[model samples]
Target chain A: MLNPPEHQVAGHDARLGGLGPLADGSGRFFKPLQSCSRGDNELSFYTSFSSDPRVPPSVRRRFFPSFHGTQLLPASDSSGPKPHLVLQDLTSQFTRPSIIDFKIGSRTWPPSSPSDYIDKCFKKDRETTSLTLGFRVSGLQIHESGDAYYKPSRDEIRSYGHDDVRRIVRRFVSDSGLASAVYGGSDGILAQLLELKSWFEDQTIYHFYSASVMVMYDKEGVENGRSGPAVKLVDFAHVVEGDGVIDHNFLGGLCSLIKFVSEVLTDPDGEGEGRRMKAKKGGTENGK
Target chain B: MLNPPEHQVAGHDARLGGLGPLADGSGRFFKPLQSCSRGDNELSFYTSFSSDPRVPPSVRRRFFPSFHGTQLLPASDSSGPKPHLVLQDLTSQFTRPSIIDFKIGSRTWPPSSPSDYIDKCFKKDRETTSLTLGFRVSGLQIHESGDAYYKPSRDEIRSYGHDDVRRIVRRFVSDSGLASAVYGGSDGILAQLLELKSWFEDQTIYHFYSASVMVMYDKEGVENGRSGPAVKLVDFAHVVEGDGVIDHNFLGGLCSLIKFVSEVLTDPDGEGEGRRMKAKKGGTENGK
Candidate 1:
């Protein structure tokens, strides 16, 4: 069963004051836009990017949600103000009300050298492959677990092969219940996944952080000849305005996440499924 | 020198994900109104208080700010919306923009039980007592020294003697350079202080937290004969609804602060000058 964490189970940073007031357990998916971890005010950056005139219409069209207006909100414990950006909520558009929050480039996932994985992903899933990959929210461990914490596992990063990628997509789809036919078979799914990854990669180049890559589909019993689900990026509090052509950190982190899932999905003797079950078994054995 | 810490110093409670974006270092004084620490959403409570029709117009006129309007702001970390109430910014009204942030009941000063001191302050300042108390940006310590934190001496929390109250006012006034005549004399300052204390006491009884009592006066060099400077309550993020009864915790805190300042100001040696010199001297020595 997809777990519904108590809505109040939100995360907070102690460097700031207690955020007890910010998280009221009401299942209202209102994510606040914060300054980037690097200390840039993301409201200004995200709002500008989402609606900035200088950005090409084509680039804007492929990604970026429709920009909602901005408003100043009271801080939790600070004597200052912050601004929040509104985007169209995906749940409102989906036929099935089920939603999951899959963070891109997050420390919660195994960390890897960022770009190596992205390049590998690009080679396999380019425009022709169109694969749709959905992530299991249950596997994304965001909470601090022991001393290891939820940060990216930077040291053990590696690129995954096609068999690996396919295996991972298989698990994600099982949870999603979306048929391979809906994805236009294997080739179509790869192409879609590649496109989704490319869009995400572009976001990284622009410096989006702690972003959520959401897959919103028709949850109805019959999607009736629909053209697959839609994936979009949201929660842009950590996005930065960059001067360099590429954000290597974003590339490396995104690559690491994509690569890890790919690894989790592969195994020739069906050992991939065995390994997946083992990991879950181990997690539960430790009383997690 | 007033030290400005990094504006990016954000508050966090991990029991809540990364508050990385919450603390941006803009010098804007925007404190968020939370559900009162008691669980009442203060934005609703304060705006309601500032605009409640049940309140007598006369009392409301004397107490609340002119109501502006309210708007829903994006939550920085959550998926739901929070409302922000806009009120007049006082800085716009003053010709010279020097402001101070004094917490109502604080740890920096000695602790006193709340009501006793409020009663003492009032009996003293009916008129002729003009005081201007701007809280120290830190605690009432008003000293820049070593890193010793402030806490009230709980055992000595009783109301101060009249001489003690007189003493504290003396030190505060000397800093202001106001004439004895302006205060209506030495006795006048104490009465005014008590009056000031009383006003703040009223605020706490009303269930305000993080409230500041500001003394606004004509900053111009000369006064053509104004009665006294004005002191109003600001910062209502923690304000709560009350049944017209005094909140003892708030009273105890406010009283303690007033009592401690009184103690800091005391000296029978007619060396009120020496007493003043001694307190400043003592503050520096303790490396406060």
Candidate 2:
């Protein structure tokens, strides 16, 4: 049976409407195919990337969800049965997963996008910390070692400032007064992200606009030092071809994220005065 | 000013409705962005292929229309302005252009497509010459020297059998009393299709489902021998990733088409009885 994803921290929710992702118990996540261009773009991205030789196998296995083609299922809204892109559920193996979705890139919209879409993205980017910080913590749920769970509301997440974001990042890594093994060591989120960054540094194949970097870790498994962490790239509805040009916008945003995560590791407390990222105006073109 | 394309022999027309392609006076074809997946798929194909190094430069340049990004244009149906993918007009330079759009592949629908879509494509393929000949002339326009023109209607085109399609193909290449210089030379339609065949023989990049191979030549230009024939692959809305596998369905259909065209080159008249291609049953899988 299909059910609302228990661990989805960001994006649309099917419990609220018919247009969100559904989780099947059999380690599968079924994302409802949008009736618009967004759905087409996302599907196309997955299809092309699945077999692309330029993307290393290690990167493909570690940083991307396994695509299992598409299927038609009954709609949650009772509108009609629609197609869904079947993907591997990221949190399927976790008993208690602590997940955070970070919407990467300083600008979400491409230059070729329609004026109205550009305006919509521009307004949202300025309203959030995205325009300033290069990346924004869209949503997060920190599961403590105990039964305690900290899931921030949408408004609260949207209202986060640079300092607030820093505090949250520190909190996410901290469990029972000690740092979790999810963000540190040789094979952790930081290392995985750096690997992705390395790929992005030279990849001139695609410009991933409005894409997200999702980081998740099983708190219980982390306590046992078993599963560690998983960092995967998600969302490609607004992705565009790079056309033999490096995506500096995404690279810059990724670097900013790395800096923040690195700071959390080095300086857990807010004692040291870290350099603040300047709040830039306009779109990604100007940010670059 | 945006105008209806004068030389567009097939596909949707903006003059009929709001949801079709428009021709800019300045050597550009503006295909209106469909609000659905088809538009997105087509856009993604063009974007990826524009820079894909796997596709040889010669193949890219000669067999595909040049892409110039997209633009927002006022809708002909007065539904307000919307985005349109801008592409190089294939017949921009021709004074009296003769064109034929051949919907290639024995099975137009992919196996992964929805049941309804498969049924629709199946019915059409059976009704036309596609199921038997591996290709169907979707539409065509023959331009004779002076002011004579022969444009087949949609119904007439649809009703064409194997023999009728052969006659039309011969008629397209024949101008006045002599055979036109558009289908026999090294730089002709046959040679270009052969080049595409060589690429498809080993290419595992994409499976072009429901794609069309368009053949066009200028009647006046043929008379002067200044410009030769142009063979380009068009319509990529249903294109899917090949996943490191050869698209045998498309390759088989292409080979069948090569046989038909080759037969025409060797025996222009219907007197020399040609081998009839067996009409295959079922989808592309069965066709393969």
Q: What is the lDDT of residue B232 in candidate 2?
A: 90
DockQ of each: 0.01, 0.01
Can you write out model 1's per-residue Cα lDDT over B161-264, one digit (the tens) per residue? 32333443443344345434323434343344455444533332255544555433333322444334444455554555433223333333334344333433
- Per-residue lDDT of B51 in model 2: 94
Query: Weakest 10 consecutive residues, lDDT, candidate 2 chain B?
Result: B279-288
lDDT of 2 by residue, A1-288 (tens): 999888899988888975789998779999988777999999999999999998899889999899999999987777788999999999898888888899987678875688799779967877787755667899899986576679989999998876667777777787534353666778888888889877875575788889999988886777787677889999889888854345656765676677667766776663442322232222222111
Model 2 regions more than 4 Å off? A176-180, A273-288, B1-288
lDDT of 2 by residue, B152-184 (tens): 799989998756776777677765333425677
> What are the lDDT figures for the candidates, one per model?
0.38, 0.76
Each model: TM-score of chain B?
A: 0.47, 0.91
User: Which has the greatest DockQ?
Assistant: 2
